[model samples]
Target: MSKRLANTLGIILALLWIFPVYWMVNTAFLPASQSRSTTPTFVPFGGDFSAFSRVLTPSFMNSLFLSLRVTLLVVVVALIFAFLAALAVSRFRFAGRKGFILTILIVQMIPAEALFISQYKMLQGWGLLNSVAGLSLLYVAAVLPFTVWMLRGFVDGIPADLEQAAMIDGCSRTSAFFRITFPLLAPGLVASGVYAFLQAWNEFTLATVIMNPSTKTLPLWLRGLAIQSNQATDWPGVMAGSVLVALPVIIFFMLVQGRMTSGLVSGAVKG
Candidate 1:
């Protein structure tokens, strides 16, 4: 009875969580006239596509490209650095190792808002403001520490014996690590990459401060849509833009979902 009750509660919570998403999608298909109606239109049968049409402007396209570039760069670069750092910490002992780990923790502890002034100045000094590279650098810094910490746990969880056995079987240390342990870390890598992707994609405050008007990301562009006119906000257009913005993330997960699921199950068994 308790188990059934728990399952019922879980389903309720899941529905509650997904309600906003369903509403956004429903609103996107709604006509402007019906979008703001006091009674909600839960279904969008025979709804107009004008909102989506309006959302596909050149400015929106540019923002979409910029966001994609920055997000991909952040995910790739953060994953590489975090992988190396995690490997070093988990597999080898070196001077100041504890201090290095402590520093990662400390960096994560610092509020991102507090560093805005300094980060802005640094990027400005480097003349990277309003550039994809500049935004990517900041995104990497923001996500790297957490990625490293998460990957390190995965690294530590893998038995050293596996790598040693491969080495004993005529494999070089580097070869053994890549051929054996690296494959095992796939789940961790995917999980961390997802986190970094979401962070870089949805991040607003830093992007607003760093990017110029011409180089706004998708989130900034969405904000612009909300306040584009002095007249009433275009709720339908905003919802449409939101749906478009989220499509890439959904597609990304779809592509990697199988690998991620297998990795999770493998990691659980290993753990």
Candidate 2:
């Protein structure tokens, strides 16, 4: 009985959590007339693709490409650097190991907002503002410290004995580490990549400060929906734009979710 009640409660909570997303989709399809009406249209029964058509512009395409470029770069760069650093700190004992770990923790504690001015100045000095390279650099910087720490835990969680055992089986040290351990790090890497993806793709503050209209990301283009010069706010168009902005992230999660589930299960069984 308790289990049934808990399941019911879980379903209810899930539905509640998903309601906003449902409404966003609903509104995106809703006609501007119906969307702006006092009565809510729960399901866009008489809706059309007008909202989507209106929202799709050259700027939208540019933003989409720009955001993709930045996000992909950050994810790849951050995962590579973090994985290496995590492995080094976890497996090899070198000088300043403790200090390196402490520095990572300390960097996380510092507020991101505090560094905005300096980051801007530094980017400005390097003539990288309003560029994909500049944006990706900052996103990687923001993501690496946490990613390294997270991956360090993952590396530590896998027992070193496994690698040693592989080494005893006529496997070289490099071969043993890769064949025995690297596969297990998939879940952690995907999770860290997801974090970096979200940070780089949806970040508006840095986008606003660093990019102009020519290099606007999806988030910044979405921001432009809020106000139209001498025109009334197009609520339906805004909602449609929001949906488009969210699609890449939703699609990315869906694509990686399978890997994440399988990796975790595989790692657990192997461990």
Candidate 3:
């Protein structure tokens, strides 16, 4: 395709993808009546914040806190373990290494639904259901394999000669790795961390099965807004809650975006 045509097509595709997000924000400002109007309003000239205000209830706050706690735990735990596993697989040749790699692939291939019953039973047996720690464990398992695979590529892309060079200059192997290699892996770590955060933050199916009503996460709480009354759905409140739910992810990306870019470029040049 011609360069001009490709650029135009790309912009069009981008707009198409962003339109739903725009509509969501737009609807969040509208009143209940306007939000459900047969004719869509392109803008909210005098939009009210009542919907947003209503979403700030104690229950919502509690659920938001729970979601944050679980997500943070998942990211920290998953990244630590995945980083180590990736380093080992990429740096060392050992017995069953291939098998271990194959196992990660096989686990990824298996559908999550297939293991729901077993997962639930295991957690129940361990007396960990409806707790942040329990939910974090499941999130770690779900996110770990992909993260290991991703970090493995990063580790493999990094040349071992740099670490060896540092070691030859009187640094210990551990010191050489930390000083010379770990810095290069920052971008990979950040990217993997973002993945873990999103997975843990937005995971609904597993949370639904694992958590009780008293320990509901943000997604579950959002679901509650929809079914608050049997009479009708609260579209406006739901939209507002959605906007709230998405804010952390957007803000997080914004906060780390510069670091992510720097890491990517540095890793590329170093590798």
lDDT of all predictions: 0.86, 0.83, 0.86
Query: What tens digits encode model 2's per-residue C-alpha lDDT throughout 16-70?
Result: 9999999989999988888777789898898898999999988889888888899
The residue-by-residue lDDT of candidate 1 on 23-128, one tens digit each, is 9899999889987788888899879899999889999999988898999999999999999999899989999999998898778766768898999999999999
RMSD of each: 4.8, 5.2, 5.0
Please identify model 2 stretches exceeding 4 Å from their true place.
1-19, 229-231, 251-271
| Cα TM-score per model | 0.85, 0.84, 0.86
Tens digit per residue, CA lDDT, model 3, 77-125: 9999999999999999999999998888777766667888998999999
> Could you tally the backbone clashes for each prediction?
0, 0, 0
True-structure lDDT of candidate 2: 0.83
Task: Sort by lDDT, best first.
Answer: 1, 3, 2
Write out the backbone clash pairs for model 3.
none
Candidate 2 vs 3: which has more lDDT: 3
A best-first ranking of the candidates according to their TM-score comes to: 3, 1, 2
CA deviation > 4 Å runs, candidate 1: 1-17, 36-40, 250-271
